[model samples]
Target chain A: MKPFDRLTTSACALPLASIDTDQLIPARFMKRSRADGYGQFLLHDMRFDETGAPRPDFPLNADAAKRAEVLVTRRNFGAGSSREAAVYALVDFGFRCVIAPSFGDIFASNAVNNGLLPAKVSEADAEEILGLIETTGAAVTVDLHDCLIRFGNRNYSFTIDPIWQTKLLNGWDDLDLTLSLSGDIGRFEQRDQAERPWARLPDRPD
Target chain B: MTATRQPQTLFDKVWDAHVVTRREDGAELLFIDRHLVHEGSFHAFNKLKEKRAKVRRPDLTIGVADHYVPTRTRALSEVAPDIAGMIRQLDDNCRANAIRMFGFDDPRQGIVHVIGPEQGLTLPGLTMVCGDSHTSTHGAFGALAFGIGASEVAHVLLTQTLWQKRPKRMRITVDGATAPGITAKDIALSIIARIGADGAQGHAIEYAGSAIRALTMEGRLTLCNLSIESGARCGMIAPDETTFAYVRGRPLAPAGDVLDGAIAAWRELTSDADAAFDRAVLLDGKDIAPTVTWGISPEDALPIGASVPDPAAMDDASRASHVREALDYMGLAPGQALDTIRIDRVFIGSCTNSRIEDLRAAASVLAGRTARVPGLVSPGSHLVKQQAEQEGLDRIFIAAGLDWVGPGCSMCVGMNGDLVPSGERCASTTNRNFKGRQGPGARTHLMSPAMVAAAAIAGHLTDVRPLLRSAS
Candidate 1:
């Protein structure tokens, strides 16, 4: 993994709570591979009109938010479903960081595993960033190492669970992490075979 | 980082305490206690057989089938042949391994998470493992539980010990009484909306507050089941009298004196009075309304009265892209009121909502009101089905012309034959209204069982509050 090449940033800030995975990639997009560029399909239904014309009342239609990498939302983001496509689509859409008051349990893991940072800041601080963007269209800066999200002279220290923090910082997936402990696992298996061969072995001849 | 008072978060305590060892760029092998198993893991059992391994504590393991079963048509035999095969495999595996099997035919048969608590198998101060992600549902009883992948399932099966990288703790407190007719499902959606979909990522959440504490055991489970959906590894509520009382007399709970000793210890599972959380959020339960997903995602929902969002309101291309796709797949016209949308079918079952109480709630609504649209009300388990029948709740569903069917996970994921045809919208009682969750191209709108019943009768999405009042 590139140590510092990939930095997590957010995408469109909906300023709402309980965004579920179904909204991210929709089960329809799950039909495709991760390489199929789900980014274009991200938030499709929310962005268009019935005839498929883009709706103008939505925030994503604004020029400033179009290319913004860091999405600062209100609170409790990604609150439904265990869909990985939501995270995949977010990452594919060029968002490396998601700043919110909260996140969904499974969606957070999916985001971290996929190299998308689901950053949580206090609601006040999040609103501050949103206010800045709203008033001046200024982007907030999130420093991963400092663990701080900075906006006009204000810095909100976002708390990250140490376990998840470790995962995001190291870019280790479950498979990678499990395989990293091969030595200890091998030792335990060896001892187990010696102590309880029957439990570790097939009853029938192999 | 700016210095601030460190809140003793649930995520911090659980994560820090559980960390056995940590290394840079590696997953930690945190110790697991009281590993739980269910029948969707027949694949894991087969893999264990391939390796000639057996479970460390066959007694510590509990298995049931939830995912592959049909819920709407108790025709466990024919609703879907694939489900039958899975059920057969689960039965065979449990018998061969000597692990306790909560088969569909068993009195204990139910959704794995529901059965775990109702059966007294979920005890506080214990770590539970299940192949189901919503296994976090055990967290409601104050147990540390989360879903594991197929490989981890095999590991837990063989060693009873499963590795975990601890998550930070988050304590989400919803204070005040929930408004009348607002179910825990509404509270959960409101929290997600407030926190954003990925707010609690990398944290184990402890739901604490008068509102949460006031919830029924089943309601707590409903909240916990969606913990992962909110980007948390697991979510839990501290066990209390409600927890103990709910667990008592179950086939799995300790009998009499044994139970007393356990209850004495269970009381200690509550979060310390002064205990702080690394993250905390206080919500007013009153502001929460009946939330419904408008687009493809759960987070894309509005408070039933809201409109199909117009992405042009967004300032960015990326955001616009997501909004557009969600509307496209959902078959919604931007600016249309969500409540006005019509529904074709109603499904009332899943690990999230298919419980005895959920059935009763839906049955109460269906009692004299016939469904305007086709609907299916599936109880979470066979026992629940029987109990509903015994109470004549089944008759209410039948009288309303709803298919009160079998004991399987029917339309929740449409793994079985119970599915909505493409482009058709359904009011589902299960979690996940993602496009195609009910079937390929089928639209699923999630709600409480009662709400699903109301929608079935109205033939559209309608607030269940009025229905609950009218039913009474």
Candidate 2:
């Protein structure tokens, strides 16, 4: 994962709200191994008809939006199941950042862990940015360090939790963070061994 | 003199109790009290096997083969290879890890969420995690429970702790009494409809007020089960005597003095009277009708008698466009009555609304009536099924021409070959109504079990209030 400073890329606008996880990557596609990329199955039902033909009118299938790196949508994006495949689909399909008014709690957490920034802006700002994209076909610039989005001479700042910003900027693995707290964790284990005996590790009976 | 102020909430107490340590960035290493596993556990188990890391607390973990196991009693040879292999992998992994498992053939086997509470494994004031989102169902026991990703699942397996940031607290108060024909499912749907999918984002909701207090244990579970669908990771209800009595004497519950001591601690888990929430939302219980979803999103629900929303009448541009898209996908007209829509099938099973009480509601509506369309009824657990049979509810369902099958998350996810065909519409008791959620090109209308049973008999959406009135 590269350290995200700033990037300007072509944007694709999906103006819908409450884009759920099941719609991002349906459960039928979740059975396979994660190593197998989920790019082709991104929005499989919405992107294609029942007979496996692409719906040309879908924004992602449109010729102008083919190589988009930034995906913009409305509030509560990724609102349903907690399938990480939803993030896999977006990232694997070359989407680096999702700009929304808000995000599903688990989905936002997963995005940060995978180095995908879930940028939160006001609903009015989101609508304005999306409007610019539709009218001018202009690309947007996302500056992580400055916490701002640039579109056609206007700058819209976004907010992200500081801890998540740190994790995303450094691309730090969560397990590594947990390992860094080993001293405190070990102390807690010792205290808990006496305080809550039933929660002890059953494998090591000692 | 110094003044003291602490806005104590139930979530605050449970969260503060489990912090192993806090980081400067406001993140904390929270200890897990219990872990539930199902077929989705295969991914985490594979990671564990690859790293050769054994489960840290095998006794604290419970495994079951749900999600992909077929509800129909068919030979293994007849099952799809991928589904069968997934179940086999779970069996082998649980055996090698020394984790207790309720396999597909075991009499105790059921949906992970259902069996946990029934077996007294989901106790009060505990932090629980599972790989599936509906794990919030266990929060009905006054616990802080939510879902985790595969990576987090593996982390919990290697070490019984997870790194998490504390979420804001929100209290959803439902005052006044509910009218007749209304159930817990209706209250949940009404709340979601009132508060859009993003209404509770970044908050853990604590359900309170008189209406919530009057609900049974099963009703509380049903309410919490859909918390995830509303964009909140968890929902909880404070434990009382109703909760205590249901948990006592269960197979895994503590005995005698230990039980007495545990109950005393749970009694103190409620929020203080002066506790201020980060945000609060209120609903009148009497205002909520038998609700139903006419669109792809759970938040797209409305009262049973309401007509499909006309996008032209909506003042908000975004909402209007959304309603239009939903109408196109659901094959509905703007002014059409929800109760006039026809359905091709019915399904009554899921982590949400598959308990014994849910079954009884459906049975009461189908006692002497016959199903006008094909439908299936899968119990949440083997215990629920046995109890339903003992009460002769199974006979009523079978007599009504509905398929009474074994326990699993059968048609809810449509992964086990129990799917509605393409272009067909179904009245489902599941939590989600995402496009093609039941199957490719299949349409789903979300409703309560009683409403679903009524639709199954009428071959179209019909208000259950009339049926309830007649039954009484």
Top TM-score: which candidate number? 2
For candidate 2, what is the lDDT? 0.88
Worst 10 residues of 2 chain A by lDDT: A197-206
- Which lDDT tens digits does candidate 2 get at residues A40-134? 89988889987899998888898766688899999889888878889889989988899999998888887886788999999999999899988
**Which residue ranges in model 2 land beyond 4 Å of their true spot?**
A63-66, A196-206, B1-7
Please state the Cα-based DockQ of model 2 relative to the true two-chain complex.
0.54
The root-mean-square deviation over C-alpha atoms between each candidate and the true structure, in angstroms, is: 8.4, 2.2
Question: What is the Cα-based lDDT of residue A128 in candidate 2?
Answer: 92
lDDT of 1 at B120: 69
Give the best candidate by DockQ.
Answer: 2
lDDT, candidate 2, B1-472, per-residue tens:
2358575899988898899988888898898888888887777887787877788778778888889989887466679898898888888888889888888888888999999899888888889999888988988989999988777888888888998988888999999999987899999999899888788888899999999999999999999998987788999999999999998887777667777878888898899899889989999989989899999899999888999999999899989988898888899999999999999999999999899999999999998999999889999999999999999999999999989998898889888889989889999999999888898878999999999999998999989988887888
Put down candidate 1 lDDT per residue, A1-206, tens digits, no spaces.
32322343333567654455555655434434345677876766666655778888877666666687887775556655555557667767777888887776566655766667778887677767777777766556777776887665767888766666766677654544454565665565556445322122112111
